[model samples]
Target: MPQVYIVYMGAQHASRYPTYELHLNLLTEIPVNCSPSESLVSSYQRSFSGFAAKLSIDEADKLSKREGIISVFRSKTLKLRTTRTWDFLNFSHSVNRNPPLKSDIIIGMLNYGIWPESKSLIRDWDLRQRNPVANIQKSEAVFDSEAPLVTSFSSRGPNLITPDILKPDISAPGIDILAAWSRVASVSNLPNDTRVVNYNIISGTSMACPHVTGAAAYVKSFHQNWSPAAIMSALMTTAKPMYPSAGQDQLSYGAGQLNPAKAVDPGLVYDAGASDYVQMLCDSGYNETMIRIVTGDSSSCSSSTSIGTARDLNHPSMALHVQSGKAFAAKFLRTVTNVGSARRSKYKAEVRADRRLNVVVNPSKLRFLELNEKRRFTVSVSGGPLPGNSTAPATVIWSDGKHLVRSVMVVYTDFSS
Candidate 1:
């Protein structure tokens, strides 16, 4: 099947040159599936000069070489709450809260399920269980608690699926969330429980997921062209690491708490694409055949030029499962593309970890000459494999003084259940 692409043209020159018309003419030559009756230009053209069009892989590559075309990228699907969350993030009351802008955005939630009666959802949600929790009410849920503490029940991870990569990438306010509920459902999913309410207090990663979804939508409202990975990187890199409570580790709160305000302008992002993830699976011992089964594409590790370990998957957080009770050494390579507004920005790395762990960042200094420029570095961590599943948590931060890009690193030994 043909896929959609977002075509971006070079900067406007003195010559207007009927740019829009030229783009349409080029599309007309391609073997597109659009009906002849359809107005391709009128319907597909974007307001910002970029146009979305469905074309075969070869057709897109062919168009990229055309004159005035700056770049062509495949348009991929991006997938995202009440958000009395403004005050929690210190948002100004003067900020515009227009329904028109909100209606254009969609925040996706996956949890035990949402109660339809909650006023926050406004009876405007679709309940679909063709495929796919608990009871925590407001009185028992604290509203103003310092977070980044993984809810006692919020699942933490050694990423059973892939131990090299961190799981639960970030945390958000999940406890005592007052949102719309299902009038047909009980407060808890227990078969014996028959309590029903229009709005109920809830908590868990499911609740946390929606909060982050709203934060992501908030970020997308500011940057429409950002990919899903970029949005995730923004949230992960800009997360707050302040310890909300004791015993919080990378496994507990991957990159830290969700900081929506800071995410809008994350200085740099560790971006990845479909191929990057395919390689990650490859490194996780998934052979080319198995990889195809998951990705639904023949793009196998054999053909992919950029092969990387699961730890080097361009993820915003790093978690390594070290051999238990034995000292170990590990190194993680990461690349960050400059996304800040400055023309030239410099960053220095600073690490904070337990005294037993020795962490070092090679070439601690990074200088980006232009926007979108990427700089790569390696973080070497040693002195791990602590007793049992005990984790040695550390933070690797790249700061340009104006923006702090941080990644949570955890070196732990698996404790068998």
Candidate 2:
């Protein structure tokens, strides 16, 4: 069967060139069950040299092996996360006094499920158990809450398109949000009701995105020169940690709820640049050709420009996906730039782990004497064997009497569970 595949060829620096010919030259020869012209769905060249085409499994695999091709994979649909009422997040109304909420990330795989009898699915009635939950009033369910609760309509996440990186850097209030809407639209989205008014309560990404962007802008207003990653690091490290309910972990809330006030003064930030990301891509087994496609430049990932493994990207959060059920150890090397209010401050590391996990931070104390000074630290995590789809959460905090820079460490057996 032919599936729509997105062939990633990296970035196309030369936008003036026609990408159809380039794509045609690469795919015209590939055997397709349909017409050759029909197989070429769309050519993308303004930003990248690639195309979306309908290809069978074997054809996609063959095209993926070709040089200059970064990746070839089937496309998956994703639902948008709902909005915050950020006050429900306790981010406060004054957070914007001048500007953020992009936090709801659909983590793990919890879909409504497709045709279970399809050959692609697990073809067994044994696994298809009936849900005990009743859906008698979903269309009539009222979402009126003053606190944070994952709604029944909370969106599900998709399969991982890349390794290591986690979805949704954070989470916010995504329920019972009062936001703007069209004046002519119905309030209840029912045909019988014709309430033509402006400003409707929404609980989707439309309002969720603004919460985070405003938070980022608030951080930018304070630190005019901080990079985008720096702002993200500050936000992640300063998020308020929460205890997960059943069937939830760090993946649900990410680096915790957004804290705009705390983020502006995060003592240190895990900084990353284009070069760091490029090095990570290269170390992860991608070649120079794919790197060129991604960077749109002649950036080389030689050994001399090393920063260690993908785990050493200086991300605010640390995660590990283990395949084996046996006891294993994971280590993350990170560098944090001191963005503290005082340069003479000294920060100490504290690790809080679950009973089944053991965590250690090297050089527990980081003392900085100059602004923008960088310090490196290593986190080594060891834990009891975890069953498939199991995850463990731990909290790592760096405190200097005044500021608390937090990072969530999660160890899971699978990203798609």
Candidate 3:
């Protein structure tokens, strides 16, 4: 059966080459005879170079093997994870605002919905399509006392794609979020329902995403030159740690709740550039060609590596999964760049783990003379054969009196894997 498949070719290398023609040429090269032009669904040339086309599973597999092609996978139906947002995060309106610079940061995401004549998805309304909103009532909003608890819908991980890397780097307000609504679309999305409202409450990963995006932009407003990784580190390091409860494991809330105020001054950040990620992919067993498909870079991986390979990424969090019935020992190397306000800072490492897990950090103390000064450390986690479907949570905190840079670590023993 034919299905729409998206071909990923990474970032475009040159402007002169027409991506549409390139996509067609690849299609024509398929063993089966077919009109390449007719198969083309659309060319994604604006941001990155790729194309969508209707193809069978075999054709997609064949296309994935093509040169310059990074990946070819069938496009699946997307489920919108829906958000109470700001106040719950303790980021109230009273917080500092830097709108002029904040406006410059663009978070490009597809919150795809009906695009009315006006571009704003939020309050710029078109009442012509529905009954006029009755009133503009102003009132104090009620709060969810148990605000930051993990919703059942949130994704859990010892990341399947790359188990070494923890998924959901962080969490944000994503339940019962009152965001703007499209007047033309039914509020309940029911065919017979004709009700339309200016705003509607929602919950999901999508809602959580915007909350984090806004926090990132907020963090950017303060540190205009911070990289995505740096900003992420700030957020993760300064986050309020969450404890696992029933129905929740260590992987659940990532680096915990999104704390916008504290993120601005993370003190130390595990800054990573493209090369670091490239190295991570390399460690994850991706070849040179596969690396280019994802990164559009020619960086090569060497055999000389740290205690751990993919797990060594200068990431804000660390995770490791082992067989439930087998004894496991793993070491991870991490580097942190001082982004603190103080010119000279001293940090001490603190590791907290379960009785069943023995965790140690090498060079438990670090000293930095100036901003951007980097320090590297290694964490060794060793434990006995744990029972199946179990997890042990641990924390590594690097603190310098004023700032607490925390990294969450989890060791899972999953026989099912």
RMSD of 2: 18.2
Query: Which has the greatest TM-score?
Result: 3
Go through the candidates in order and give each one's C-alpha lDDT: 0.75, 0.72, 0.80
Higher-TM-score candidate among 2 and 3? 3
Return the candidate ranking by lDDT, descending.
3, 1, 2
Give the alpha carbon lDDT tens digit for every residue of 1-417 in model 2.
799899999977554546667777788666677766668776765446778888999999989998889999898765434433444445556544332132332222222222334333345423456753434332332334433444434442211544455555777665456555565565654433456754565665555566777678777776777888899999888887766676455766678777787888898999999988888887677888999998999987786765456666778888776665789897888898988879788999998888778999999999999999999989999987888767778888999999888988777776442
Regions of candidate 2 where Cα sits further than 4 Å from its true position: 1-86, 89-146, 152-159, 182-198, 303-308, 415-417
N/CA/C clash count, model 3: 9
lDDT of 1 by residue, 1-417 (tens): 777777787444444555455556767766556631232322222224556666778888987887767888987774312336666655555545455555576656555565554545624434333442225343221244654356555677878888888887887878767666777775654333466787777765667788788789988887766788899999998887756246566777788778888898999999999978887887778887888889897867755355567898888888888887788988899899999989799999999887879999998999999998999999999994478857878888899999999888878887677
Q: Which stretches of candidate 3 lie above 4 Å from their native place?
A: 1-84, 92-100, 110-135, 183-186, 191-198, 297-308, 415-417
Error of 3 at 37 (Å): 41
Ranking by TM-score: 3, 1, 2
Best by lDDT: 3
Residue 388 in model 2: lDDT: 79
Local error of candidate 2 at residue 375 (angstroms): 0.5
Mind giving the per-residue lDDT tens digits that candidate 3 earns over 260-322? 888988889999998788888887888878888887766777668642478888899989989
TM-score of each: 0.69, 0.62, 0.72
